[model samples]
Every structure is written in structure tokens, then in C-alpha cells.
Target chain A: MKKLDEITKRMPPEFNDFYRQRIDFIKASIKNYFPDQIDKDFLDRVVGQPSLFEPDLKATYDTIFLPTQEYLGRGGKVLRPVLVAMCLEAYGADIRDFEPVFGAIEVMEDSSIMMDDYIDNSLTRRGGPCGHIAHGYALANVSSCTAFALSHYLFYNNELKLPDDKALKLLDYMAWEHIQMAFGQIEELYWTQSNVNDITVDQYLQETIARCAFLTFRGPMRYAGILADAPPQDIAVLEKIGEYLLVGYHLKGDNLDMSPDSPEWGKVAGEDITTGRRTLLINYLLDKADKQERATIESIISSRTEDEEKKKVVYELVLKYDIFAQTRDLAAEYNQLAKQEIEKLSVSDEYKLLLNQFADYATRRRSL
Target chain B: MLHHLIENFDTEFLEAFEADQRTINECFEAEYKKLSDTEHLEQNVIDEPLLAWDYRAIEPGLLELMDPFMESESHTPLLFFSILRDLGLDPKPYVKASLLLEYSYFALGVIDYFDFHKVFTERKQDLLTYSELTQVRYAAQYLIQYPRYLVIKNSFELSKAQNIALHKLYATIGVTTGIGRGAFLKWGHDYFVSLIREHYFQNSIYTLNNYFLFPAMLGAIIADLSDAQKDSLQKGFSALTMFAKLRLEKRYYENQDEFKITPPIYRDLWQLLSFPGMALMENGLQVDPAPYAEDKYPWFTGLYRDLNTQIQGIDMADTIKTMEKLETELFETFVSELGRVDLLPATVERLRNCYRM
Candidate 1:
């Protein structure tokens, strides 16, 4: 599998430098935020009773918690929490005070992935067996709920020592984000389950904005503004920027999923098509393809086969239609809009530069 | 029935209650008329269906929407009105809020129908047209946005804090009912795996709790109860949800697979017993021989036999009698625990009757 650095190396030197610095910052922050060792004592105390399962039930707890631990270790961009910390830093808030918020967001993201992998029946994630596959769906489901509960605990415990009102506000925001993400997820599920053929780009965009964009962009950015005690207008602006960034980020994700360079992507490529996910790429192809082409694509999607041969056929069509480039352009367009939104923000230049660089990387990142 | 529910209230309260009901009816009528007036606007649209936006056009079509897809029921209005009346709040804004909730529910139903039809059911022609699909998609978007719109619309009446809380609660309702419940059903259908009887039964109960029972309890607290009283009753409400789950499970056992799967109302009972776990018990007793029984957990073997025999021979009327007895005991316990708080006696009575009815 290609290292993320290899992908970053492909970008211009300045952009690569910015990206590397951002990654290093995130890695260092996470190291500081989490305990150096998740030893038995730490797990028992922090993860609480789940770690102290009775002898017979120890395996069950391991089944659930170990996969979460494994998946967290096999980290991706750590984008959401890093965004939270960056925004807080930009606002000159005590970034360390908001460690719980960062942890909560990262746990929430990982939990969503666990549940998503289960729901999508994904066999592999980050070049390893998905949580549900390594464990079982039942344990994976339980772990997802546990992660949500832990996020709730982070807020309720108010380890940041925020005022009551501020803590409540943060809790309210997290709840709202969770509900919105669920709504978005349900829409995607509904679309895939229905396997509706007449899907329009508008519908695809709506689902993407809800499922991918809101949590990734709007929610994290808004949370940052809230913690900073920024005015409502500023938070609103942050939300707008986050929305554009989210759309672009989601498009990049879809492009990677369909890319033939599977090992480099570090995920099971073509899982979207094989699982019949309603992607921007699929919607675009449906809109552009001729009748015979449309039928062929539809047949492949509906077949839901994991065969390499069928996946090859679909990938060939994606290439033939230049769907990857088209999607990439759409992402770049959103990234541009995001940059424009950043310019409208009244934040310091440092914050602006950091956000712009992040947006640039999001629109360009080649690997998962 | 409305009068009976609130007969103990003062004349002023009764009049206000009646007026709120009237207002709710009038608002629904106006909304429906607006929907009708714009029906023509959707007729010739070439875009993919924005069914979510043009909800009224799909309102009537809900009756024809098949099983496993939610349909708006008469109980929703009753539930809303009852909660408002019991709380003694000025129902005007809240009634309007309920309409937003109802519309979201309706939109979810329409989306579910489209999804379910696409996934199952071989009738190709009955699938939503492009225009109808657009309507449903738009309706879903509307559903997601309803809480925000409700806050904006009612911000003047509701405090900032109250608005935030209400928005969170309403969003909870939408997610819990639409996605949490809907996804479970879709997953079961897609996998062709037999539903776990426990999950199937408990999920149905939880669905009712989230959609109907919890909202009513939360509404009363928001509208009427003091902060301390609200805290006290929250525990009771949680208890009642558990009771309701047990009640629903007993109901399913009593009914067996006697109910129809279509029309959605009786579908839970049918679906709950459709899992592979229940397959052995579906026919007359046909237990695996001792060798197979030895490999299985001893307790499960015993429990399965007991369930099969009980389900096979149980009298519906007797089972209902037993279930009602158990429910009454649970309700009494809830009322007693809740009575420790300083809520009005009438309010306590209202809580009891709300669930009983």
C-alpha cells in the first residue's frame, strides 16, 4: 500500500509542506490527548465496566473493544478533531482545555465508520478486516453504541470545565449533529436499498451533503466557533465554509473508492459499486450514459456481485465516461467555493491560511 | 372522547383546549388546501420528483403505500392534542410545531415506501415516477430541516434555551423513528436473515416509545411541569417505556402470526415471528432429536419448547387478560413513583390515562 506521504509527495512542494505540517500537528496533538499507554488499568478505569467483563463475558468485551482499539490505531486523516483543534487554536482559545471535545469527535467518527462498515457489509477497512468481519456484527453494533455513549460521557463529564450553559450548548450541538448524520446516513441507506434507477444528481447531492458534508465540515467548524464564543454570524460563516469543504471532501472520497489503484487507496476499491451505494459518480454516469450503457451499468449495480470481473466492467465504464475527472472537477469547484468562504471570514490570517491549506489538501488527497 | 379525557379541568381550561383543537384542525386544513392548490404545479415538472417538497400530492398516496413503510395515522393528532391539553400550555405555537413534526413523519413514510418498493416487491410499474421520486427526496430534506424551521418560526414564543431543547427533541424523534427504526427493518429485509425475535419485539416497542410515548411525556414536561417535577417524571417516563416494551412483546405472543402484513399496523406481529429462530416453532412441535438438543444450550432448548407450546395453545382473550393485568400493575407502580413529586393530581391522572387509552 502506498504511504500517505507518497500521495502528498505528488503535490507541489509548498502544498506538501503545509499538508505534512498539518498531519504532524494532528499526530502530536492526538498523542498528547490520549494516554501514552492504554494498559489494563487505563482501560478498566476509562473504558469503565466494559473492560471488567466477567470471565465468561471477557471475550465479548474484547470482541467489541479490541476492534474499536484496532480501528482507532489504524487511523485515517483524523480530519474532524484536527479541524476542531485548529479552529480553537485560530480563535486563541486554550486548545488543551477542549481535549475532551476533540476526543469525543474522533470517537464519534470512528464509531460511525464501524457501524457504516457493518451496514455496508464492507469486508476490509484500512487494509484490515472491518470491525464487523473481525469481530461479529452483534459485537460491532454494541461497540458502535459504546462509542456513542463514551462521546456523551465526554460532554456530560465536562472535563473541559466549561460553564454549565456552554457545556449544555456543546451537548446540544453534538446531539443535533448526530441526528443530522443519522438522517444523512438513512437517506443513503434508503437510496441503496431501494436501488432506484431514476436517481438525479440533485438527490445525490442532498444525500451527500447530509451524510458526508455536515459532520465532516459544518458540525466541526460550528463547534469550533461555539467554543471560541464567536458571534453567531461568525459561526454561520464557518458553517457555510464547512459545507463547501464537506462536499469537496466527499467527492474526493467517492473518486478514491472507484479508482483502480486499490492498494494505494488502502481500502477495498469498488466497494461502493459492488454494494450499490448511490454515489455522485454513479448518478453522473446514469445521466450521461446511452440507453445500452445505462442498462449495463444498472445490471452490474443490481447484481451486487463482489467478483473482480464485474468490478472491472464497472471500473471500465467509470474510466470510459471520465467520471473520475468529472467528479474531481466538481470537488475542486466546491473547494474553490470553500476558499471564497474562507476569504469572507473575519478571522486572523493564520487561521485563514490553515483552513485554505486544509481545504486544498481535502480536495486533492489521493489515498484514504 | 376529548371531553371525557379532560372532564375534570376547569371551564376555562376546557374552552382553551377546545379552541386549540379547533386551531389544529384549521391549520391542517389550510396546509392541506395549500397542498391541493399547488398540486397542478407538480403535474408537468420534468425534474426528478421533489416529493419531499410537494408533500400534499403524496399525502393521499400514503394509503396505497405498502407494508413496512410508515403511514400517517389518526393517533398522531390525538397524541399531540392530548399532550397539549394535559399540559395546559397555550397550544397555538406547539400545535403548529406538531404539524412540522407530522409533515416530517409523512415525508419519511413516503421515502420509506419508495425505498421498500425498490428493494422488495416485484411490481415494477408501481414504482415511483421520476417526479414522485423528486417529491420524496425533497420531503426527506424538508424532514431534516423541520426542526430548524420550527425554531425560527417559534423563536419569539420560545426562549432561546427552550427553542434549543425543542429542536433537539424534535430531531431526536425524526432520527429515532425514521432512521433507527427504518434501518433495522430494511436491514432485516435485505439480508433475508430471520429477525431475532427479541430484537424484533423490543424494536417495535421502542419504536412506539420514541414516536408516541416519549414525545407525549416530553411535551408535558416542556409545556407544564416545573424543572424539578420534570426531572422526577423523566424517570417514570423511562419506566413506562420499558413497560410498554414488555406489553408489546406479550401482545405479539398472544396474537402469533394472525395479523396481516399489509396496512402496516399489524405488520410487527407478523414480522417479529418471521425470524429463523421462530421457524422451528412455526409448525407443530418438531424438535431435533437428543443429539441436536445436546449440542444446544440446555436453557434455550427448554425455553424454545415452552414458547412453542405456549404460542400454539394460548387463547387470545386469556393472553390479553394477563397482559392487561401486568400492564396495570406496571402503570400503578409508575403512578405511585411519580406521585412522590409535587405535580397536580389531575396531571398524574392524565399521565395514567394517556398510556391506558
Candidate 2:
């Protein structure tokens, strides 16, 4: 795990540049769009307490907002959204006007991560208490709501300035994204409660691909493609790039399941076990092992012991089958595929640089 | 948008409302006379302390947009009318309220989902202007704020009127029964109890909770404490705890798949985690038969009272006589609609289930 530190440290710099390039332009565009500030006081009056309308404002407005803004304001990886901006930048389209597009998307991604961590019940992210743990459930719940509101508000605000047809389409796209995410959550919840054979590893992988990763992953590429007004074939390729990144992100959870450096998900470790949440790791181990070993794993999993040593031993047994290496190989394969797609594009020199940079940065980052 | 709203509300009911305003006015005046006699009745006053729920303002712009509707009731009392106007629909206050009741009974929680909400929701496209959302938002806000409005309206109406016909109206209907004039105390008890039962139901849960809990908690808090201190914070705490317990109980049934795995009670589960709101209603009255009959009525016909002229125990022997000439007419209007409440009919079997063994 210590040996991996160098890779993690080096990984974020390119992402930082990626996001900075985005926010700088976003700040300007949003300013141009709304010359005056939105009057936070008015928003506060409408929001009231943290009801469904004002979820995150109710939850993490006090707790996570300050820190999250700082974290975001300071240098960090803007890998996903930057890819989107870069992809658009690569295409022969001018997108300096669409800054809120990036800010709103970043907000959505942050919410997804915050919520995912809570669901995973893993503690810590970027080396701090998980949002749920620090802010409390109400706050965490609100944090998600805030992101949702921002998305809707952004769509609403944008709708006013854009053509009515395009505004509706934008809303429709958002609704589609929400439904997909919700469907994915239902699948995960079902797997968590029911038997393994009832669940499919491929389905889990696919959900991660389409829902979690695709929204942000392909968002950049598609955004870039659309902004640059690229060919449909290029858009299709960008979608695949998103699918690749999603699968790679799920591998980050492999550390939570099979690896020894257990903080892999921080505080939320053992959440899946506590929740009986099935993942590919458990599915593979069950498939590879005999009935008795499967039963052994089931029993230990059911107990949900917090004992690190005991869980570690079980994790080690699963690891012996070379699961992590297998997962990594799959990741590498996707990376190659993504590269092939990038190669076909007659993108600008700047886009080519961004594509290569994101590919390397994604390949290096360990956790989802 | 306002024109569109007016079109949806153009029903035979409005014509009758127009034709019968004088009759309705007379009916209310007659009832007001009797209510004046019973004005000092012992039951309506709350001995227990109370406080307002959170002093939340309606979204500022929305409230200003809705203020005109709240002023529409020069003929009928403003208690129920403001609810409609306060909400952004065309300002037929009672008509809108009655319509809201239709949705309130069964479509409440289901409406929270975007699709179901379309019944209550203006299409996002339809709501092109910011003022449109403000209007829709306030109209909904009026419903959400129904209790406070009801309290204000009821107290004002009751103080002026002498007829108890309005009292009878509340005893029979679910819509106007909540926060009606003080004579509807019996009706209120029944209404709240039925609400307690239905509040566990998904379709009714959120609306009932939002409608009923907001006021009950507000009243419980306001009755005891002042605006400045709200010293009845403990009662507020109790009310909140009670609400949460009911919420968890509802959730237990709501998530049936997960419910199967969950223990029947949230007590142990909550205690382990120290849920902030447990044992909320421990101090309140623990009456048998769940306190009030689950099947609420707009009128409480007395079970017993000896008539001066009757020999055999007259059913109406013990009945409390109507005090106003117009009371009879007001009571008639309420009865006419009893059979038409199509949402979920109060069947004999349902009533039995709500009753004691």
C-alpha cells in the first residue's frame, strides 16, 4: 500500500489542471449569465429547513459545504468533468460560455460520491471523516438534496435562457440520468438483501458502468462531442470511454473487499458486509470455491464482525484465487480500448494532450 | 396560467355557490346564533400548554403573490376559503379545499412522486414564468399551512357566529373537520385519531403528517409557550418524538420487504442507536379503544340524554337540541355529500376494524 503512495500523489496533478481549466471559464460564464448574484437570502427563504426541496442545504450546508468548497476551491483532481470540457474543447466547438455546465456537473459528481460513501458505509475520503459521519444523516441526506436542487435549478435557469425545446430536452436528460441512478440503487439494494445467485456480477458491473461512471465519465466526452459538434461515431466512442472508467472505479472497491490496506474505503469498510451488499468480489469467490468454502464465507459475512484480523484472514483466502490481479487486468484491457478510441479521433493537439493525460491519471488513481 | 386554472374550476358547484350565497349566508347566520349560546363551552379550551410549530414563512415572493386570494371570502367565512386562494389555484376557496380533500384522502404520499404530483403539479413547461411557480408553490403552501390558517379562520368564525351548523359540517367531513370552530372538539379528536391510523398509509401518510402533524405540534407548542422563548420546547420535543415514532412505525409497514427482517417495534433498534425521538407520547392520555372512534363523522349525535316529554328511552331523548334556525339547513348541506365521498368509503367493516373488541 505504501509503495502505491507515489502513484496516488502523482495522479491528481493532471486532474487539478483539468478542473482548473474548467472552473476558471465557468466562473466567467456564470457571471455573464447572471450579472447579479442570485441573492442567497431569497434562496434561504424558499428552502426553509432541510425538506426534500432543500436536502443538502439542510444537511451539509453547515457541515460539508465549507470543507467541500475549500477542497474543491483548492487544487484537486477534476478528472471527470475536465474530460468532458476537454472533449468539448477537442471538438471544433466554443464552450467558454457554458461554465455553469461544468460547475453543476461537478456538484452532481460530488453528491454521488458523498451518497455512495454513505451507502458503502465506508469511512474517510481524501483523508477525512466521511460526509455522513461528520455531518450526521440529516446533513448527509441534505447534501445529496442540495446537489439535486442545484441540478434542477441549473436546468431551470438554463431553460430560461435557451430555446424552450432545448430546455425541455435538458430537463428530460436530467430526468433520464436520475431514473438510471435510481434503478442502479434498487439493484444494489436488492443484491444487498437477497441471495447471491439471484444477483449477477455482470449486472452489478454494468450498473456501475452505465449509472455511476457513465453520467460523469461519458458526460465529459459527450459534452465535448456535443459542444464541439462531433460526429455520432465519436460520441459513441466517448460513451465507451465512460463505461471503461466506471468499471475501473468499481475496482477501487476491490481494495475494500480483498486487499489488506482496509481503509481502502475509509470508515465505510465492512458496510457492504453489514448491509449484505453483494459485489463482484463476493460473487467471484462464491463461484470459484466449493460449497463448503462458500458456506464458510456466508457464515463469516453474516456475522459482520468488526474484527480486522478475522476479516483480513477471510479476505486473504479470497485474494489467494488472484481476484485483484484479475480485476486489474480487466481495467488495463479497458484502458487500451479507451486509448484506441482516442487514437481514431482527429482531435485538436490540446484534446489529444487532455485525452492522454486523463487516461494516465485514471489508470494511476487507486480508489473509486 | 390563471385563466387555465379558472377553466379547470368551472363546475356546476360554482354556479350553485353563486345562486346560494344568500341562502348559505342565512344558514351560517342561523348557526352562528346557536354557536353564540355555546361560546363559553368548557370543552373547547385547552388546559394543556401549547406552542406554534416552527415559525416558517411561506416563500416570500409566493406569499405576496397569493395574498389576494386570501382576501376573497366576503360571503362565506374566510377560514376554509383562504386555503384555496392562498394556494395558487383560481380562488374558489371552498371549492379548491374540497377538491384538495379529494386528493388528500388517497393521493397524498403517492403525489410526492413526480408523476402522481402532476395532479397537483403544474407542468414545468406550463410554469414558464417564475411567478407561476410562486403561485403554484403558495397554493400548495396554503394546504401545507392549512392548520394555521384553519386555526385563525375557525377562531374568527366561531367568535362571530351563533350557529353550530358549521360544527355539524366538520363532524361529518374529513376536510373541514381539522381545525374547525371549537365546537368540533369531538370531531377533532375523531379526525386526529383517524389521521393517526391513515397517516401510516403511504398515500395518506405524508400529507396527513404534513397537514396534521405540523398543526398539532405547532398547537401543542404554542399553547404552552410564548413566541419569544417557546419555553414549551420540552413539549415540542415530545411532539417531535411522537411524530418520529409514528414515522418509524409507518416505515416498518411501508417497506414490507425490509419490514420482514425488521423487528416489529423500532424500540430496541432505536435505543441501541439512541434515536433522539423515542417514547414521545408517554405522558399523554392513554385512553382505551385508541381514544376516539376511527370512523370520524361531521356530527356527534349524543348517545344519551332524557327528553322531558318521552317515556321510553328516546334515541333523541338525550340528543342535544340544535340552537339555531339555520343550523338545520347547514346540517342538511353536510349530509347531502356524505354518500358522495368516493375516495375511500367508510364501510361498516372498516368502522368495525376501527372500533374496540
Give TM-scores of the second chain, every candidate.
0.57, 0.21
lDDT of 2 by residue, A218-242 (tens): 6656655654658878777776776
Give the count of colliding residue pairs in each prediction: 13, 44
Interface RMSD of each: 10.5, 23.8
Highest DockQ among the candidates is held by which one? 1
Worst 10 residues of 2 chain B by lDDT: B46-55
Q: What interface Cα RMSD is found for model 1?
A: 10.5
| Model 1 vs. true fold: TM | 0.65
CAPRI quality level assigned to candidate 1 from its DockQ score: incorrect
In angstroms, give how far residue A341 of model 1 lies from its true place.
4.1
Scoring each candidate complex against the real one, what DockQ results?
A: 0.05, 0.02
Q: How much DockQ does model 2 earn?
A: 0.02
Write model 1 residue lDDT over B1-357, tens digit each, in one string.
Answer: 112222233342344356655776777666545433435323411112322332222343222232123333323454466556555655566665655555555554544443333212222222124224433434444344433433444433655455545544554444234323343433332232333434443334333334444445447535746656665555555445545554544545555453233356323322332222333223333433343333211222233454456566644555456556756765665576567774435645654554543
Model 2 alpha-carbon miss at residue A283, Å: 1.4
